[model samples]
Target: MSEVQDSGGEKKKGKKIRAKKHSTHIDMTPMVDLAFLLLTFFLFTTTLSKPKAMPLIMPDVNEVPDPSKQTPVDDEDAMTIILSKNNRVFYYFGIKEPKVEQASFDATKPNSLRKVIIEKKKECESRLKVGGKTPNERHKVVILIKADKDAKYKNMVDVLDEMNINDVPVYAIVDITPKEIEMISGL
Candidate 1:
């Protein structure tokens, strides 16, 4: 706050005269204190964003597969997909050695691998419903993903993404068998 007051000066011709100017003073202490308090309050109340995490389910190395608790996935219900180099995909129903067939990565073409995955999911769900299974019981289409040594990493990622998109619940990346190598090597 500032205030001004007239200062008496020397009288001239018996008339009183006042000084022309007065120094002004201002108080900034309260404003500075309020600014610091607001700053401190905001610093204490603000929350920092936490890093997001992806849910990863790792297989237990020591735990063996229990037979009684495990419901056997029929070979006919299982689909095996093999990713090779040059954007090639080989898949088959049932075991890898006896009945392996080839598929293409192109989604536009008929009989694409994505269509096969959707068909398998529908077939598995329908079969479970016919067997009098409840909604709570998760009957998923089993798919085994095998990648060759020279397979593109992008192709492997794309296959995994397809599994997710198709809602295929039971899928794993398995080692390629010698028979599978020989079967595809003919191409």
Candidate 2:
């Protein structure tokens, strides 16, 4: 009877120990699904903005000179100077055809156009002064400058400085048309 009672007590204790060995696990399926949804939302909703541009203000010329007071003759004195991106300088005098001057610059060297323009300005001024006529009084003494689209800002600035030094004030800038911009952009 004692042996039977001991065996029964040991079996009960073993059953209780087995029952106390418990495990608890949590499911992470919902958290992982939420993370993936947030990633997808960010990937599809963002966009980059276009770059900002600098503003340019050009000089205005509205008043036309009186034709009755002016004498029309063959092209003798009007000058048009063009500065090209390929470092070419062109001049047109009293004619529609332009003459390209053999001129070039080393990208690493200082600009030589400034000196050339200064000399030209002096020549123009001397002609006007010796002839005893002001710029407004002379119809054929005007200087027109047409700069290239890709010319350096510093080069243009040097040109302007030369003009200022020589008292050549009036000038115009050629603009790129909206159609040209569209064609270039393929829009």
Candidate 3:
């Protein structure tokens, strides 16, 4: 808002009548109040986005482990993924003598890591008992993640992200044995 005020000064040297000088004043209190009001309005109306987190369930430390009574994962439903140096990924199904196969993280490739994860998950799900009506009732696919000492941390994170993106139910990060390191050393 603006207002015009009489300066209350008359020129003595002027021969003819002239317009009187007026000073202009602008009141900024209302503008400041309106800005604060809008700021508060927006602050009250909007909801902040929650942070994203990867869900990981760990076994209780107090529970005594019984190896014999533990549920055994079927060979068909078990997939082991290994992260190696230079962004190398290797995976093999089952615990028996594994035939390690190289995989790529590139989505554009035919044999991308994401595609492999999805395919393995489907394969495991297909073998589920027929009586189970829903995905929860069926057996979960077990994925074991192992990273070599020389493997980059980013590669491991990428592998975990792939597992999450593909919805692989049961995945665990395990220590890589020296033998496994030797297995991928040549690659």
Residue-by-residue lDDT tens digits, candidate 3, 63-145: 99999988888777788899987788998888887778999989879888888888888777766555877766666679999
Question: Which pairs in model 1 have colliding backbones?
Answer: none
**Alpha-carbon RMSD to native, per candidate:** 11.6, 18.0, 10.8
- Those runs of model 2 whose alpha carbons end farther than 4 Å from true positions after fitting are 1-74, 86-88, 104-111, 125-141, 174-187
**Structural similarity to truth (TM-score) of each candidate:** 0.63, 0.39, 0.65
Model 3: CA > 4 A from native: 1-63, 130-137
Candidate 1 vs 2: which has more lDDT: 1
Tens-place lDDT digits, model 2, residues 1-187: 9999999999999999889877767898999999999999998887667775533346545767687976553344455555555455544454555444433333233445544455555555455433556575443245556665765675555555555655664544555444333333321
* Best-to-worst TM-score order: 3, 1, 2
Best by TM-score: 3
What lDDT is obtained when candidate 1 is compared to the true structure? 0.78
Flag clash pairs in model 2.
none
- How many residue pairs clash in each candidate at the backbone level? 0, 0, 0
Better of 2 and 3 by lDDT: 3
Sliding window of 10 residues with minimal summed lDDT for model 3: 1-10
Task: State in Å the error of residue 165, model 1.
Answer: 1.0
lDDT of each: 0.78, 0.55, 0.81
